[model samples]
Target: MKPINRRSNAPVFWGLFGAGGMLAALFGPVLVFITGIAVPLVLILPADAMSWPRMQAFAQHWAGKGLLFVVVALFMWHAMHRILHSLHDLGVHAGTALKFACYGLALLVTMTAAWILVAVGF
Candidate 1:
């Protein structure tokens, strides 16, 4: 019998990571259902609906918010990797420029999320 080759796992890893993030997003609703608490639907609605008390509750529930952050950050990292590589493949080969642009965007997104999480006291 021939041995299985396992080199083509990058796509598999990315797919699983992305799916996990989606699941985490979905889990928020499940939590709301179980707890009978109306958490702000950040994933589905605009920031205007997010109130201070809701934010405080969200932050206080460490597990859910931490899971949310993990999902978002991982998804962002994976997306940035894929996007930068795709741009490079298209011959946009200013390596330093691409690197800085991608990293800067990622940082901005992360900071925004962090601020929201903190502002909500989560």
Candidate 2:
């Protein structure tokens, strides 16, 4: 008897969520520290560590663009998945429409970020 390949795509979504959660946990605080404290307080980075021109250049760079894309996309997937699962955990009625809406919003944000980054020019 031939067995059917009935695997689901849940792993992919879970992987994205894991990556995003890790990134958010690791980088979120570091980013905030650098931008909010270090730059302003002259601790590690310079005052203009996040200046406009520098930020524009970062967005224009290939590595920066990819980093931005991955972070944004993963974060969207993580947030959407969390929300969907949390609703279920909280005993809320999570229907297909809710799934579509949450995932759809994540996709929308990711696409918008990508478009804006591309429009920012390379």
What would the per-residue lDDT of candidate 1 be over residues 5-90, giving only the tens digit for each residue? 86754575367446645765676476565444343444555554456676567666877578667666656655676687788889
What digit string (tens of lDDT, one per residue) describes model 2 on residues 1-116?
A: 77869896779779988999998897779878887789889997877888999999999999999988888888889999999999999998668799789888988999999999
Give candidate 1 misplaced runs (Cα > 4 Å). Answer: 1-56
Enumerate residue pairs that collide in model 2.
Answer: none
**RMSD over all Cα atoms, model 2:** 3.7
The lDDT leader among the candidates is 2
lDDT of each: 0.64, 0.88
| 10 residues in a row with least lDDT, candidate 1 | 33-42
